[model samples]
Target: MTFWFHMNGVGIGSLKVYTNDQSGSRKLAWQRVGRQGPDWNQGHVRIDTDVQQVIFMATTRFHYGSDLAIDDIVMDPNPLVLTTVSQTYPSTASQTYPSTSPPRRYLTCDFEINLCGWEQDGELQWELKRGASPDRTSGIVDDHTLLGGRQYAFFNGHKAVNSSYVARLDSGQVFFQPGVNISFWYHMNGAGIGSLKLLQRTPYGNVLSLWSRTGRQSPEWLKAEVNLPPGLYNLTFEVSAQHHFSSDIGLDDIVLSEETIS
Candidate 1:
């Protein structure tokens, strides 16, 4: 059995699931406590014995302590099975399996905890901030990753001097095949906003511009997607800011995945 749940608010509380047998014996199957942020979390449980009843409970300390939400409950009779093969091979022989491993996402970052292996390079640095920018004259009030409950990478234009200031967030080297897609959410709002550029740095010390946006955009978060040719390269998000407090910019939820086609 599997289900998706979300929890928010102040106080202390828990979301619990129980299974009761025909003999009136009840056992706790799954449980979660505290806040799980603004995004939905997945929970799974396996029951070998017959379940006569299933119970879902949400407990809170006070009226405004916490809130629990559950959705998309799924019950699967056939659980996952693991198989092992035993083989005796000669010393001179070898075995190999082609395309047997499971598919995986290349890179995913929300900046919820930290930079997720990204590095900062330049005169100015990008800050890991929550809620809103320090100046508060521009930028988003909440992060784009989880709306009201997450942190994002932000660049403050107020720190710029008489000359244009440049800040960069660089990703580690990633192998890109055909149909690889990169997507991210950004918030560019302010009076003196400058240009935001996405550059691909190749292994041979070559830099290629992929995508870019200039000037002030909407106050809300906007999404951007880019598709690159097959190669090995590092991704750099470079932002050039003018000298103004209102030229703040934000970035969140960067994902790199393979696009499936029919």
Candidate 2:
């Protein structure tokens, strides 16, 4: 059995699953007795013998504000095989179910032909340009998509009247499952570089700041990744300039895919 669960404010409470048969009852799974955030997490359990019933229960010592939720429970007759994948960042090891599961790519954009589905949301817009930015001192010298051949999105800091001037690129509503991977290449070069923020706006009008980077980075493009939770949300890439021509920022090769499990 496989399912998705979210736990919140469970200070001393525990969530458990059990399988019962003619032989007896056995605990199948249980969550740590602590507070887990709103992030959706995957759970799996295997039953070897014939089971008459499956049960999910929550027990708590303090019942004031504890919350435990579960969803997307799937029971397959076929046996499931688990595999381990080595990861350098985020964690040292990760688990993947069903070794044949392949990552599903949801979106991929190079900004070579157009902005794809991305839209300009603020007054200071993201411009599609090739090679260096207008000022040539800040921003990327070549697009990360094709080195010197293709185009990329650039925010011209030269036009900013003040340091508060922001350029926003928004990806309209998209559906994402739990544990999706969002990645992109960004260039923040120049003496006057400012800040870049990645935000997630939910359907209920709640906005969450996922990631942010301030100040100037390396002259070459750098990669960034965000592990997004399950939801239908809009993604916003916001850049604020330092009111200098060299404060420009560049973004390229945006991609979103299911978390790779190998």
Candidate 3:
């Protein structure tokens, strides 16, 4: 099974999986998983035994800087728990909210021309381009995108101590739906050491991290999904890199809707 979580920083703890033996004694199946630095980490463990439960233990040298958050736990074929029935978002809507009283819109951004009015900031270089080239000589194309198009959010690492970029919605947007979810396509490739985080801003100016992943997830574009409570919220997309000039990260097709998949 594979699980995703936000470690925030290094030296946190470990997650253990356990199962019962034939003698009815509890035995450890797998143990000790952690991510380096402050970012999200995806962990995978193969259990030969019939797993019973999982446990998380903090090491003796624990530094309580950031809390651990886990989400989107997945196995190859299926999952342990189901969250939603289906996943759908209205892509054609111009505005993020519905014209009616109850609010019925699915916000979308393809990065064609920055029509969505998203804000950008931080150290890592971010821009909209047709696509990135995968080459070593030019040192430009660190990774290839899964979605082929005329434009996508291309995040490139530069020669700097800190490398990061943030794309977010401006504050004070009203969302009246009972349930809402945010989804996007991201391609984190190459030999870079960085992390991507999906954050939500509340009405009281509080920022809450909902989902994240670190390092090279895959060569192809991967979908990241997160559920939000019914209320007003501002979304922020953040990518940070530790090593300079490692590789490039690509983001495209962002959607916010009242749908999810279990």
On lDDT, the leading prediction is: 1
Question: Model 1, residue 180: displacement in angstroms?
Answer: 0.8
Q: What is the lDDT of residue 124 in candidate 2?
A: 72
| TM-scores of all predicted structures | 0.57, 0.57, 0.52
Report lDDT (Cα) of residue 73, candidate 3.
Answer: 72
Clashes of each: 0, 0, 3
lDDT of each: 0.71, 0.69, 0.54
Model 3 over residues 89-151: C-alpha lDDT tens digits? 787534343232211222366766542435333433356666454424332332234345557
lDDT of 2: 0.69
Q: List the residue pairs that clash in candidate 1.
A: none
Which TM-score value belongs to model 1?
0.57
lDDT of 3 at 85: 36
Give the alpha carbon lDDT tens digit for every residue of 1-262 in model 1. 6678788677648787889988889987556556656677666555544688889999886678477789999887653321222354788455432221111121367887655545556667787788877656676798975558689988887788843578877654555556656788999988788889999987577999999999889888999988766666677899987656678889988876655323
Which sequence of candidate numbers ranks them by lDDT, best first?
Answer: 1, 2, 3
